[model samples]
Target chain A: MKSRDLFKKEHSDEQSYVVIHPLDDQPEQKKDLSNFEPMKMTFTVRLSLIILRVYLISMILLLAYHFLNLTGIIKL
Target chain B: MEEKSNKIPDRVDQPSTVIRTRYRWMQKIMLFLVVFGPGLIVMEADNDAGAVSTYTQAGAQYGLHMLWVLLLLLPITYFSQEMVARLGIATGKGHATMIYRRFGKWWGRFSVFDLQLLNFLTLVTEFAGINLATSQMKLSPDITVPLVAVGTIIMVLTASYRRWESITVFLCLLDIAWIIYAIRLGFSFEKITPAAISFFPSGQGITSSYIFLVIAVVGTTIAPWQLFFQQSCVADKRLRFSDLGYARLDTMIGAIFTIIVAGCMMIVGYMAVHSAIGYVYKNPAQMATSLGAYFGTIVKSGLLLLICNASILGITAVSLSSAWAYAEVMNWPTGLELKPKQAIGFYLIYILGVLAAAGLVLIPKAPLQLIIMTVQVLAGIMLPSSMIFLQLLLNDRELLGNEFVNRPWNNWINWTIIIGLFALSIILAVQVVLPQLFSS
Candidate 1:
């Protein structure tokens, strides 16, 4: 009876190990919620944005000068 | 004893088992073949007739002085274009698509409008150039028009992507005719030192006429359409991030080819036209005729044919590029892959552009020369804005990611082009405004 009980206990322990091992091996599954956050506009990005703006302004001014000259409005 | 048994078993298995390789040699060959299209196409297209005419005129009028300018423009072209390739890979979208997404609808609308107008104007020039060349062979515009139109339509429509690319590259190879003409012009291999060290201004006066040509050379070399076209092409081809190195190599090869062709063209003009004991023709066709008079009828006719080929091919390429950009911006069907019916609206615009330009040429009293000059001036005016947009796009981290942003060296080079172009625009504006200012 004692031997039979020990065998039963060992089998139960092995079964439990089998069940828990898979649970442990399976990584925690969490959806990456960080992507759900709105895109943040940082300082470097804003600075780059400003550079583009400046470039546009300069181009506009230069174009205006060309048109004025072509139309004989500006006597440069 | 147990360790020895385990090692013996492992060694025996290793000796018996085969090692599998992940990458095949054939895969490398296929990748190379696929990557081969854009670089050769772009470079060959640069040797188109209008570009040839520009280079010829530059060399004939300025001699070897402006040859240095071509050398200078090389790096600018490579740097600007490589950025486009990166953008394409990073975004998986054309330049126009990215512009729409990042800048909103207003800017998107503006860019489409500008590109379409320019594309139309350029198409007209291309037809004009074709007609001009065919006319030299005594082929009437009537015959030439239908023939060229049908031929181009069939070629683009019937051919698959790989075939279309190959055919275009083959046509581009005919641009080597320029090199042949250069050789005939008697450019000594030993004369490199003299050509390199030569410093003749060759300008009759310190006038704005001279300055305008300088600017024109720069403007023509780094046209705005090239930037949009190249990046979008790279994106369309689905080049991966790893292929960036190969793409950069492609662009460098293209720039080098452009410079070599431009250099040879200048030498041809200098040796043949500038040194000849006769008046130089004002136009490229006229120059060809004069070259025929001096060299041989065969050489002359050959050059003219090559010029026409360049113009026609260039127009077709640029028109298709514009159409692609427009279609992408509006979220319509795009690419040469789409059937004509499916992409009707897209191709209709392109076909209509060709027809309108051809029709304009058929008119009795069209000022073709003025039309050409207007195209150049318009291109000049629009250049600064194009540069501005390109610079913005290059610096955008969200668009390019951290890995692809312009390095300091890249930024410096691009800005130099911008500054140089701006200064030229200013000078040209001044020159036009006060025609008599520098007449003395």
Candidate 2:
């Protein structure tokens, strides 16, 4: 039987099936889920730090640039 | 092929007698109502505080020279957004989620970095907008800022998709204020010449300052955060192929509204400020005040109140979008559907973002002007890269399948925007750097 037909029959039988072309008949590999882990770090603290740092740097650079421009230290 | 006669009389042949339809009329009705969330909300969010401010600035500075850009962006915006809609529908995934899954951790982390940074900066701008708006009303920021923040939290958290979308659409309609304001400008209808036609640099002659502002207008319009937010909204709303028509319609309406508002703002600036006087104010409030003084009190009050309303509405929408993008990237429960407990991290992060922004405003020594300008520059720098990534992702056949993919014409326009933005950015940089070098 053709692999496509065989796979269809297996699917109808409530079984997982993998089809490989005759030219490249490698066996299908399944991913192992046992070692999977959730992300570490408290979401609140990390997110807060990220937001704080972004705001601070942006504000500093912006003000410095503006001051320089306004004081005629920088043109345009 | 030979066994067709012995196939136990196929289901089609046996089903001719006594047909009974299993109807799902009510379910279909409910689904139709629910699909309204993403399209309307995303569109309204695009009109947020920064956009209003940018439009106002563009109008004030260039008069109507940049009006063409707005008209041009309409189709571009619709096409780009439609691609995102398709991505969401085909994959049942958010933009960030797809990037993580397909490209693995490196690209995913890079996207996260870009999103978080941009979201934070944009959030600060939103807060500043709210502050600017409220200050015009003579309302204290302490009360106005907190009241607006709390109100947004309550609205986004408490409302279901149907209720939330209806309210957002209602707020979206407030954008009509621009139309009303623009009508007041009274540009010549017969001749219909664009107000400011000169391509030469305004004020400091071909300087970086003018170039940066020009780039800022474009950058702020088609932002990176918008891509993540819109795609996630599309996926979360669970749009399907059948709904593509409605989705496209929604996007077209939004793009048109965005451009119109932009055009009006420029006209108002041209008529009220640029024509009457040559000086440019630091923000929208001053411009509105200038309008009131030159035109009348009615125009002033109308512009002021509209600015405030636009600011509050925009901040709320963009903040929620930022939160949604972050949550989707982290693979956490994200959306207005989730309760505080269900998405504590998501909600908390958003609240922290608001508070930090507010805190910046409260600081005695903070440079608000610089913060706003830098945000604009950063937004400009990030836009081209995001467009490139979006174009690549949309064209990937494995992701989009045969249903939808970029055509050559689409590629032409997308590349045009990319090249245009790059040239604008370079011009802005040179404009800024060259003047300083020569002057020194």
Candidate 3:
């Protein structure tokens, strides 16, 4: 008997049956996506990265300044 | 070789193969039902506890003059979510995994770190909302918080992806109560007709406080956790390329539904403002209390129930986003379809997040207001950066190929939206830090 058929027969019931298709025989356990090449940082990509850093830094500084003022550590 | 079975399974649990339908419309409908859950849940879940507070507050303070903001956000919300769904369908990977791979280690780690931190803080707010809502009903947080925490954990651990999605979708549909409650509170098309298109303030003229409120509405509408949640959800569902059209429709429907629910919450606020009682409450629960005193217990209980529902939905989606993102980056087994043992790290993260947030809410004197402030600031920092990555990924033909890559027009609209979001983020940050600067 075919393995799929035998496995199905064992799990089958009066109301429902498990369909073990070829695709379901060995389900993917875990994915290792480390092998794919990272995107090349072209000038546009590089510039976007630079812009992101600047944006993040400025936001954090603004937050720090606000905290200082809130705590009365800074008058201005 | 065994002949391949041509039977399509309708329900997730039932393993029956049915004959293909003759009618094309029938087939299309079937296909749509299969692709429905993620988009609707994410969008409805967006109207979580914090959203209830923000939208209700907007209506109470400004009336329906701010309805145009929600209308403007409809297209923005749909377009941004459509891209995230497209990426998930195309790449079969979570957002965190995509960032880790495409952006290299430093940026990837930074994105994940920021996402986890913000999501954790947001989860705390969800629990706090739960506590507030339940307290209105004389239910102590000591009992309600732990009960809710355990319930959230059990829902995920015991069910398959399909069953869990069904339960979440049911909760999403329960938002219909908002519309019904608004009607009971005297909402009508006649009242909203003027506010729908009016772009100016009514009660208060455009001040720093007005701008601050506007920014809050925008920030609430388009959150950073949403991107992580929907993408991971799409990937977990294993949607095919053919399902993309249905997924987009699903997202559009979700966006519309969320806006309506949000608008109804605002109506509740608007009614309170117009009422003899007036609008003097701090949060949704308080608003419910004051309104309840006038409108009766039904209104109060209805609002509290809606809050608990929203918080539960938020708790599920937010914690799932954190777990899925963390697992994807760590390359652990992920997906709600897997048994708990098979996805130990993923399930553990979800449980830990719920417990930690609920536990904090239970602490007598925990600075939850401070945490909420920090969440707003971090969300301000996080949203723009996440969008930049999303835009970059969608543009990368090398990653998504021509079929999935953003067209020229898409680039134009998306970039404009991202810049607008960045501006709003800056406004949000400044508002958080220097309240006096934006003080009326």
C-alpha lDDT score of every prediction, in listed order? 0.65, 0.62, 0.84
Which of the two, 1 or 3, has more DockQ? 3
Tens-place lDDT digits, model 2, residues B1-440:
10112222123223331122223453333334445556555655766677777777777766666776677677767777777877766665677776666545765776777667767777667777777767776788778777777766676677354456667777777778878777776665442453345554245365545556566666666777777767777665545554566566767767777777777776777666654566575677777877777778887778877776676666666666667767877778876566788888778777777767767766666787766655665565555556656676666654455566678888888778766765665444334334454342
Q: Scoring each candidate complex against the real one, what DockQ results?
A: 0.03, 0.03, 0.17
Per-residue lDDT tens digits for candidate 3, residues B237-272, read 877565689899999999999999998898888887
- Reference interface contacts recovered per candidate: 0.00, 0.00, 0.21
Question: Top DockQ: which candidate number?
Answer: 3
DockQ of candidate model 1: 0.03
- Per-chain TM-score, chain A, candidate 2: 0.40
TM-scores for every candidate against the unseen true structure: 0.79, 0.74, 0.90
The window of 10 residues in a row where model 1 chain B has the poorest summed lDDT is: B1-10
The predicted structure with the larger lDDT, 2 or 3, is 3
Question: Least accurate stretch of 10 residues (summed lDDT) in model 1 chain A?
Answer: A16-25
Identify the superior model by TM-score, candidate 2 or candidate 3. 3
* lDDT over C-alpha atoms for residue B318 of model 2: 62
Q: Fnat for model 1? A: 0.00
Give the TM-score comparing model 2 with the true structure, all chains together. Answer: 0.74
